[model samples]
Target: MKRTSSLAIRTASAALTALLALSATACGGSGAPKSRSGGPVWAEGQGATEAVGFMRVQTPAGAAEMKGAVQHGFQDTTYLLSFAASTGDAEAFVADLRPEEALRANIPRDSTTYTTITPWSHLGLPEPETQQKVRTASVCPPCIKDERRSAVQSITIFVQDIGDGRARVYLKAF
Candidate 1:
């Protein structure tokens, strides 16, 4: 009877994990209207022409409530953005992120294809080496409390390079 109960508990835990994963994927936001390719809108901007794919995410604004994020199309690449609250009561609310999480979450591991997650090195600004550095700026205790508050929504853009060194833009969000 003990063994049977253990099996049931394990099964229940697995089910719960699967449910949470599914729920997280849906947390970013609602899906946009479908196109023939069934992807998000990609007009034109930045180095988008150099992109191969992308993802967009929009998180909810509140307490522990889950936020919304979305993935537009499937490409050889995947990306993820992690938003965390870094500061105090009011100030800690701006949507802050752990870039490392973004890097790891960018690609899905179970798939057979190769997916790459690169930092936006081209943004031309010095990036913080540690997640703390990134989190520190906007999440400081009292600075820009309202504006810096981590309650945020972000859109991460992915692009796959074609033969000509140009990429197709893919959108992902969190």
Candidate 2:
């Protein structure tokens, strides 16, 4: 009787081990894949082509040196991009980005709760504390439709004229 009981216990233990191994394999291990678990990162000197790939706007042909950052959460990716264009291009640049259209640089979007979580400090772009003398254009997806709306569900853009014919572009999309 004792021998029979010991054999049954060993068989049960073997069966349990096999079950656990199979379970792990089917669940793809105990952790999230590397792609989904990546952390936030910043990249500088992004060209017009690369910057446009991440956002909905087409920077001017003469857009200057650009900066970009990406924060990858487990479920979504937040993209931040900054560049400078001639003040003349600011109007057309914000033409399509209308949801938050006409935002002023004086407000400092980074300090606001309604604006993007990505900060201007990260992009090395300063937020001037001037009044609404110069209009800033802000736009987004679905709020204002466009062909560029295909890839992303959310976007917010701000083009501020910082004087001297230079306008700064701050963009966030996911």
lDDT of 1: 0.32
Off by over 4 Å in 2: 1-49, 104-106, 109-117, 127-138
Winning candidate number (TM-score): 2
lDDT of each: 0.32, 0.62
Give the Cα error of residue 13 in candidate 2, in Å. 41
Model 2 — TM-score against the truth?
Answer: 0.56
For all the candidates, what are their Cα RMSDs to the real structure?
Answer: 17.8, 8.6
Per residue, candidate 2 scores C-alpha lDDT tens digits across 84-171 of 7887776666665665545644454333543434455665655422223334444546665656666676766656666798887767
Structural similarity to truth (TM-score) of each candidate: 0.19, 0.56
lDDT string, candidate 1, 1-174, tens digits: 999999999999999998877776676433333345544332234232222122222332432211122233354222333222212311322233222122221332333332333332323211223112122221121233434323333333322222233222223332
- In candidate 1, position 72 carries an lDDT of 32
